[model samples]
Target: MLQLIEEIVYQVTGKNGLTYDTDFVQDLALNSFDVMNIIGKFEDHFDTTIPTRDVWHLHQVKDVIDYLAGRGFTQP
Candidate 1:
């Protein structure tokens, strides 16, 4: 799941070498538009919808993993 998240982020940011500790905004310098794009990709990839308000709560790669886990997403 982390791998897939990393790929999705990379596909949008074109930045690699991400860790679970990587901060989407602080580390990657992602702006709101970029963030929304990433979240959109995540939704499409996982086939689930994420509330816009909740996207703000996902600050790190680990946060994304946990959110998906809560949704019962267990695959990479």
Candidate 2:
């Protein structure tokens, strides 16, 4: 799951290096547009809808994993 999330992040941000603690904004320098794009990709890949309110919680790679886990997604 982490690897998949990293791939999505890389696809969206075009950044190869990332850590679980990396912040999308602070570390990856992703603006709102980039975040939206990432979110769209995530939704498409996961086949889930992330609530707009919950989007802010996904600030790090681990956060996204946790969110997916909470949604009943297991590591593939």
Candidate 3:
């Protein structure tokens, strides 16, 4: 799951390097639109719906991994 999330972040930000602590806004310099697009990609790839209300909580890469994990996502 972490690897998959990293792939999504790389595809969205065009950055090859990232860490679990990396922040989407502060670290990646992604704007609101970019974040939303990434979130959409996440939903599509994971086949899960992340509510808008919970979007703000996804500040870091780990947050996204945690969120999906809580939703029953597991690493292959």
Best by lDDT: 1
Expressed as tens digits, the lDDT of each residue in 1-76 for candidate 2 is 8788788878887886777888888888889998888889988987888888899878888888788888898765
TM-score of each: 0.94, 0.89, 0.86
- Clash count for candidate 2 is 0
Error of 2 at 48 (Å): 1.4
Ranking by lDDT: 1, 2, 3
Give one digit per residue, the lDDT tens place, for model 3 in 1-76: 6678778877887875778898888888888888788889988977778898898888988888788778888763
- Tens-digit lDDT string for candidate 1 (1-76): 7789878978998987889999988998999999999989988987889999999999998998898889899887
Q: Assess candidate 3 and give its lDDT.
A: 0.81
Better of 1 and 2 by lDDT: 1
Model 2 is weakest, by summed lDDT over 10 consecutive residues, at: 9-18
> What lDDT does model 1 reach?
0.89
lDDT score at residue 63, model 2, on the 0-100 scale: 87
Top of the candidates by TM-score: 1
| lDDT score at residue 65, model 3, on the 0-100 scale | 79
- Stretches of candidate 2 exceeding 4 Å from the true structure: none
